[model samples]
Target: MNNNAYNINIFSGGAELLFDNKRHYNIDLPNKDTWKLGDLLIWLRDNLLSERPELFIQNNSVRPGILVLVNDSDWELMVSSDLWYLICSLCQILCKYAPCP
Candidate 1:
């Protein structure tokens, strides 16, 4: 198995139903040096998501109510070209708030 790992935490905010009431996952990222946020998103859709993925993603981006943080900082701060590369360098968290269901 691939050992490139990422830590992720999920908060329901009513979205947990689609994820089988589960809230956290540790994923082994694909072994690629160019891995980026966009790549991670696609990986999540394929690997971690359960159903109704639209609640977490829309228009090839995260839904409005979702937040992405990296190493305790907002992912927005480091965004470039709709992607941020080499995300395996730190912890990542994707969370949703309020009635996002």
Candidate 2:
């Protein structure tokens, strides 16, 4: 395990269709002393997202109706003084989307 790199697992629920229909992914992020959830989002959008990026990203963040979970916890609950949450090594990120009627 590279100390500077973070190996993370990403899972997609209903949103997997945008990721080539793959539900799980293991990826290594470039070395950095600190990584924020926002950074990860950009990385996913640039690297993992396969199609229909508009449906996944909006205003530099995930579009409405998309749920992002880090280590099984809702990202919204993890926000603090800084809106962007910190991410650690071996973290698990899940993106789920629930369409509205």
Q: lDDT values of the candidates?
A: 0.69, 0.80
Tens digits of per-residue lDDT, candidate 2, 1-101, equal 66535444455567888888888787777877788899888898899899988988899888999998888888888876567888777777888887656
lDDT tens string, model 1, 1-101? 35467777664566556567788777777678677787787777777778888777788887877766666667778776456545664466656545533
TM-score of 1: 0.75
RMSD of each: 2.8, 1.9
Residue 7 C-alpha lDDT in model 2 = 41
User: How high is the lDDT of residue 74 in model 1?
Assistant: 70
Worst 10 residues of 2 by lDDT: 3-12
Off by over 4 Å in 1: 1-3, 80-82
lDDT of 1: 0.69
